[model samples]
Target: MPPVKQQPCPFAPLIFDDEEAIGELSSVVLQLHDALSTNGRCFTTGATEEKAAATRGRIESVLLNAFCTIFGQSPFERFSDIFDQASYLAEHMAKDHIFEDGNKRTSLVFALSILALRNVPVVFPDNPDPKSNPYYAWIQDLVSGKRTREELAQELRSNHISK
Candidate 1:
């Protein structure tokens, strides 16, 4: 039998179907939904963590007022601004105890979309290697008060906007 050769995907520019690509998008949407619907339940199987519960309350209040307070604009802003806001919200929300599952995933998607809209250069892999990616730790640091908003903003500017 002759060996078969796979042709290049023409839609590569418009769409990506590799496991990484598919999982990348799915992870984002799933995480967002999970975080939103969790009702502040702790992700653990047994007793809920007190800090996590508190975080969830704080997250809900913030998400509810995200548009009015932070952006002072409608959610239907230009795609760029919308994305930036989403990213910011996702990052903040992930640190909170909003969902029993998928908080980080949700935040990552939000951040990626925001950067895409801003035309800022940010990198996010489909199967994110936590050891290499600074995103997860960044969010943790953010929640722990180790990283200030100004520092995060500066990082975004230096890494994405400036480039």
Candidate 2:
């Protein structure tokens, strides 16, 4: 039999990296969610440490599925814009079913941390009503594919969002 050749993925552009920093940040996000969620009943209160760790791992894995190229065992995306990267993180985390509770919230915080790491100042709504809050609507738009990653990045840079 002849050897088979691997082909490039058409969806490679929609991936992210599972870095140690993202993993650590996810742990913190999950911990905060567990603590503040539904008075500590957001479903993580009873989860074992192993379960929490596994969730963190899953979050990292989900983030690693983006437009990337592997080089010498290391994978990297084509773009390095801070706003773009951070926005994508939040967008993916929100869309991907990676948590039983506080998924979007955790993802937002996690993504925001990425911005903080680079000192990219951003403003976000503080649990506003979806009907009245543009930020909340923006998130909905993002999940629904109405808003592009670049759009979100622009919003973050503009600081038009309010808490």
lDDT string for model 1 (54-123, tens) is: 6445654544444332345443332133334544565566776455565665565565554564465565
**Segments of candidate 2 deviating more than 4 angstroms:** 1-22, 36-45, 48-53, 63-77, 124-127, 160-163
Tens-digit per-residue lDDT, 110-163, candidate 2: 666666655555766565444676665666788889988789877876872323
Q: What is the Å distance of residue 20 in model 2 from its true position?
A: 4.7
Candidate 1 residue pairs in clash (backbone atoms < 3 Å) = 83-114
Give the clashing residue pairs of candidate 2, or none. 12-67, 13-67, 14-66, 15-65, 15-66, 15-67, 16-64, 16-66
Off by over 4 Å in 1: 1-61, 69-88, 124-127, 161-163
On the 0 to 100 scale, the lDDT of residue 66 in model 2 is 29
Error of 1 at 26 (Å): 16
